[model samples]
Target: MRVSAKSDYALRALIEMTNRTAERAVSAEELGRAQEVPSGFLQAILADLRRAGIVRSQRGQSGGWRLATEPTAVSVADVIRAVDGPLVSVYDMRPESVRYQASAEVLQHVWIAARVALREVFEEVTLAQLASGDLPDAVTARTAHEDAWQSH
Candidate 1:
């Protein structure tokens, strides 16, 4: 399972915004520059986030984007969902929804299990936790191991 570019860009932009005052909106240009993401793609991601209620936009001469809720209240999973569709998808379908023959029946459970493991990390981590460089104990433990840093 891997995060899509949209989700990655959204999270990076959110982290950038996390450092600013909630009342102070950041422009797409600024966010794009800060995160090195394409401004056009970032704008589209931010619009989706706004529609999802994850971020709010102010339209006018003095307008920009801001988080709808506190940084700590926003979870990585939430941002991912707001930008991408689902956490994990198998062949463009949910693992539970797919049917298989008796030999492959157990595969559904395997995919679901994969999703569960992803949630354990993403859902447990909040934006504030990431910005502070103090992840939850579970996440920290996962990173503490040298193997965790290695690309499989």
Candidate 2:
């Protein structure tokens, strides 16, 4: 499953917010700059995040955005789902929801397995773990694989 730019940027922005010690609201501009994401695109992603209840926005001079939930409670899967919908889809349909012909009967299982594999990583990680740079052993072990850093 390919990770979308939206998910990457959303996670970056969330991590930045979590890293900041200030209680002040974080402007879209600040977040965009912090992650080096285009301000316009970042704003749209932030809107998705807000709508998902992952973030809260404030108004006025002191108003901006902040996490609606604790960092530790917000998983990477949550951010990805909030920004990009399903983790894995076959022909735009969910893996389990897709029906296959006899020849491709096994394809659905492959896609569903892909979804489960992605969840094993994303569902296991939280914004706090990412921001702290103290990833769990399971996450680190995945990194230990020599092929993990190789381009597909």
Best by lDDT: 2
Q: State the lDDT of candidate 2 residue by residue for 1-152, as single tens digits.
A: 78899999999999999998357899989999888999899999999999999999999989888999899999999999999999998788898999879999899889889888999999999999999999989989999989999988
Q: What is candidate 2's local distance difference test score?
A: 0.92
List where candidate 2 sits over 4 angstroms from the true fold. none
TM for every model, in the order presented, reads 0.96, 0.96
Q: Determine which window of 10 residues in candidate 2 has minimal summed lDDT.
A: 19-28
For candidate 1, report its TM-score: 0.96
- Per-residue lDDT for 141 in model 1? 91
